[model samples]
Target: MRALALYGAATTLGSLVLTALTAAPAGGAAAPAASAFPSFQGAPEAHGTELAAGRALAAGVKFGKCPASEELPAPIQCGTVKVPLDYAAPHGRQIELTVSRLKASGKDPKTKKPVARQGALLYNPGGPGASSMYFPLVSGMPEWKKIASAYDLVGYSPRGVARSAPLSCMDPKDFTAAPTQSPIHPSDSYKKERIARAKTYAQGCARKAGAALRHYHSLNNVRDLDVLRAALGERKLNFMGASYGTYFGAVYATLFPSHVRRMVFDSAVNPDPGQIWYRNNLDQSAAFESRWEDFRTWVAKHHKTYGLGDTAEAVQHSYAKVRAELSHKPAGGKVGPGQLQGAYLQAGYYDDVWAMRATALSQYLKGNPKPLIEQAAPRPEAAKDEENGNAVYTAVECNDAPWPTDFETWDRDNSRLAERAPFETWDNAWMNLPCAYWSAPRQQPVDVRAARGALPPTLILAAERDAATPYKGAQELQKRLPGAALVTEKDAGTHGIGGGANACVNRHMEAYLLTGKTPVRRAACAPHQEPNPVSLDRHALPKRIPAAV
Candidate 1:
């Protein structure tokens, strides 16, 4: 959310690859213009060609035929409308962001309205890059469907994300660097080269993306949402966004509060232009260190169960030894720096996977790191064919907010932070290094200040010490957004706030979405109950909650 935190699980997930681990960022997706300007009544005559093309393409977002199509599966009935490359200048180069809806699979039509079509309940997952394309099926978030039973569940892919014209930079494996200590203090030539490499990646994106990249920022995404509202014929927009999506929703709330209906920003992002993504990533390094200690302390207490080490410091040595060994000769044929970095990255997201990570590392230290080794994202053999789910990861991050292009600036800060925060300082530095060479023309991030004009006040969910989007960030946004109630998990290590089996939080969310009943006053949303393996497997079946919009 702060930078790019993906909420979805991957396709070929390991059996031990717990859902609790934070998902790596994914960035990519694009869009095009709509029929004329305001096609609220129906698809415009001027855009007849696009309408036809959309229908043929099975975009699944049929706006002209709204109420009736409300009964159709999003992919089947909705028209995949296109919008401008730049909203301020509608005729600019454009891209397509897929929009779909599971129409209220109910008997009633909004034509029963003075209320005007229960509007639409839109959803977005985090990863300044993640697409809500799959939100219709995110197990714990049936709130989309629940509210959709009356309204429609509109899911959209952010710019250059899934099913859209995604931002293609380097392959995913390239981002997955070797897990060596990306220490800050590199020699003069090494520092210069890394900075140069960052510049090159940025320049490559500028070349490849061209003018189109300039318009792909979040402000554009918010404008696109307005276009979506117009296309849907909905006077107001109802949205539920998580993680980075929350930031998206918050920006929209500030931009178009009058048009927003029943908005819920769970696991928020606030684009503070003053807040550098790189420096914030440094903060994440500290948070991850705490979680690392949590794991070490737990492992030490249960020495027999884990047998990894007796003390946190000892485990640290073991970890360093394994890292050193892997550096000289990877455990399996391929597990190297990237694999270790990735596995460790997983630990930074949530505490639920701490034991599993420990187990993997412990086993690896004990000579059986096959499971952990496999965790490393495989290197791509072909450059062009190597596009990964993480392409969007770069797209959103590098473009969402502006970063200083001067390589020397990064080098100085990165060097200073590396001494104590070695685990992720360098890894994070390289992960974001591409931004220095981002293809898009830099745009200033929106201030994302709260609106003085209030909408239907909603609940804000945040973890106290969320690594990716620090809990304080949530409070910052809360301070900005007037008329919003704050719910904090006292000591949040939970990135998504109310995740896993967090009943107290989920109940409030469910109640809020189901009956528009939020916590009457302030309340301490409880911590996520420890995951019950049995309960989770059973929940593997898609969960649905009707959205009685």
Candidate 2:
């Protein structure tokens, strides 16, 4: 499954709202001392009593200059924390986690005095593999100003991610080395090819990552969160997680209920151990199919601008024509039926890009392939990062729970779903197919329901029509967390809905985070209006569309 993509956007209120866009232990063998690295001047000092068993681990953190990033406009402190690779063997091998922080304070314009601070708010952008280190970039946005002044916004690249003892399954070039294969194809040969590809990828991971693959599951990640909490000197953790991060937060609260002060789950994962991961992906297929229909309807309504079709059926026909053409001769010698599906997959996540995508399709049908090629072609520079994300995503999910070892079961299940939920069924199945051949031993799913009454009043946010995490998961999660409230973006289908997409939802989140007041048991906020074709801005298209959540 893909995690949430954290993007920043300025709202009408002049505040920066985070918009959906899309652990472990100490112990084992001795590692290098923190003092060996040069210390950063004026960085916040570690506080709070350290864990009795791993006091040395918590006390050894040292901060330094962060890697320069074009994504981050302001400088933030960065550091590494050593964590036990296997919590059961605390004295065993250790791995380093890259941590970053945007402090909670700024000068008051007139008085030029510093604002008071109120603990820290840690964030995870849900990729199981996504890097959260750049999350603090939202600090200067108006919507984030209040939260920024009150709490230090902290982020970290979890185990197996970039600069955090990164994991790799194959060389960067190998990621795209395979010829494009369309998931929509129904032939037996296609299935055989996909299975072979999945097995090859798994073998590569085993060859390269070795034993590290077994340690990147959710359990170790939750343990790492505790270690980070202690390192930050906070007795109780304050966190906001989206997509898979919701699952991460729920597991943390279950494992360390006493250490949670305030937590938020946006676009929550269904916590039913029985539904975890496999069933959940199946759910996404149907939901995404529905959202795709919504997109076709929207494009149909704007036929004058797109000239593709004036009915959803007609639009779909136009799309099929483009797919057939691509399958015959890939646009720009890169985009094929598979790439075409990949580019349009963004429509299932966020409707904001509907016009841009529709425009690209319309242009392609009119004999211009530039727009479609630009949207579908992969960039060489991003190959490494993309590979890293996929590796971690596969490793964590595969290690976190048992997947059917037989290919026959997967084929049967997905083939049934493909009949009705054709849009994402096969593609999603292929994305997770590597799990069947995963080398690591699987662990049992964490029982989040075990934490029902033991947690703080956490807030949960979701869009009713969210295809990625699906709204039902949010409702399921609410039942699993006793005091948590569910705030729904009524009639909306976007994934990751908390930062500033809707003012009503934002108000509820702010109230809960700032004052510990959970909204009424359930709340609903009117959805954002659909995009207008007449006023659509072509240049506003995101350079890269985020993958599934």
Candidate 3:
């Protein structure tokens, strides 16, 4: 799942496309080797091939100027690390993964010279397909100033992601060539159409990406991360991951516990092997429904400002009315029921945008649909990136674990959930429909449990009301990782907690990263205050809203 901004970087909904452990040691003490741990199911043996690849990356990376990006304005260095396309055959074809770094620099308080460096801190911003090459630049943002000054901030585009042998399914124009189709349709005909489209998309991926799709699962991603660690010349990895990234960190820790220095998992995915992905998506749908109620109530409480409703039910009616009207006649010939739902889905992920979204709804109700239209309109320029993200999302999720091949199972499960949780159930189902027809051979889900006395102290951050990765998942991760600590933002519904507006959450994260000090086993922080109502000026809204996987 795509995470909200890791350190409050401004991310549009378009950018985010849309884990666990056990603990043994504390600090950086060496743990048992990979052979001492239980084997990961369907994982290639950690022998000659893997070791050779690691040695190759240890030759070191040559830094150079990074590609220009308005999204990443910091003076960052970029390079690539070559790894096997398929780890099982490391001597075969190689793929280059794009990497970026923001070298740490800060003066010592006592001495006039630079402070001693604290090693590299690698970041993965979720997306089993999101390009994290810009994350190093994101680390340079003020929210991460302390961490950035201590460690070299690092980011990379994982296999099959942008600048890393990106996977492509169809032409960029095809993404916006047709009017958006709402996934909430109740008709059997609509289901058939969606299934057909899913098949077509899957076929396109097979045609374009070919056999390389088979090598893009979590196991390889974990392997790639290790190679990256070697390329950085770090004996141990200091890391932070959010959303699906939490799972990535968990798998890496499981396979290479001795290599972990300090790690942080924000908005963790459920670590149960049974919930690899499909069941987790269903759970996400229900959680989103709950968060949506939170949004509705917020709008109701501020009814005077929005004028759309005075009660939660009234707000729901207003939303339903707007969705119906958009279905019949799309606003500005672009934003349809599908686009409208996509726009509002952001509210389920973040409360910061609630006021602006509510104001847009009010304007639409007043016959001025421009605000709503602007919110949902597609950016043709971003279509290619979106396509790459979607392709990787399906490729990794589908390849990472087993998914039911039958459409009937998906239809029944989602149809039943949609009755009670209407906001994101259908939309999420359709987003993952491509998985049902995925052509890549699937692997068994990684058993994320770590060996006894193997892992180091890990910190997990979550919001009690997170919709993308629910609060329960964090609790589950805490259970799975023996010595880990969980710091929750009580009653908060935001997807990503660390490096956010919550000072308490940031304190816990900074403490853990800077000093390897974890909070009490189960700690809680007060939620950030809910946003106050605002005027209808779209520009007045906060530019950043956490995007979900």
Sequence-dependent TM-score of model 2: 0.88
Quote the lDDT for 104 in model 3: 80
lDDT of 3 by residue, 307-350 (tens): 87899999999999998887788889888877777778888887
> Mind giving the per-residue lDDT tens digits that candidate 1 earns over 120-204?
6777766666666544443225433344455566776767764567776554555544444333346777666677766766666
Ranking according to lDDT, highest score first: 3, 2, 1
Q: Could you report the Cα RMSD, in angstroms, for every candidate shown?
A: 11.2, 9.8, 7.6
TM-score-best of 1 and 2: 2
Ranked by TM-score, top first? 3, 2, 1
Worst 10 residues of 3 by lDDT: 13-22
* TM-score of every candidate: 0.77, 0.88, 0.90
**Candidate 3 ranges beyond 4 A from true positions:** 1-45, 69-71, 108-114, 183-185, 535-548
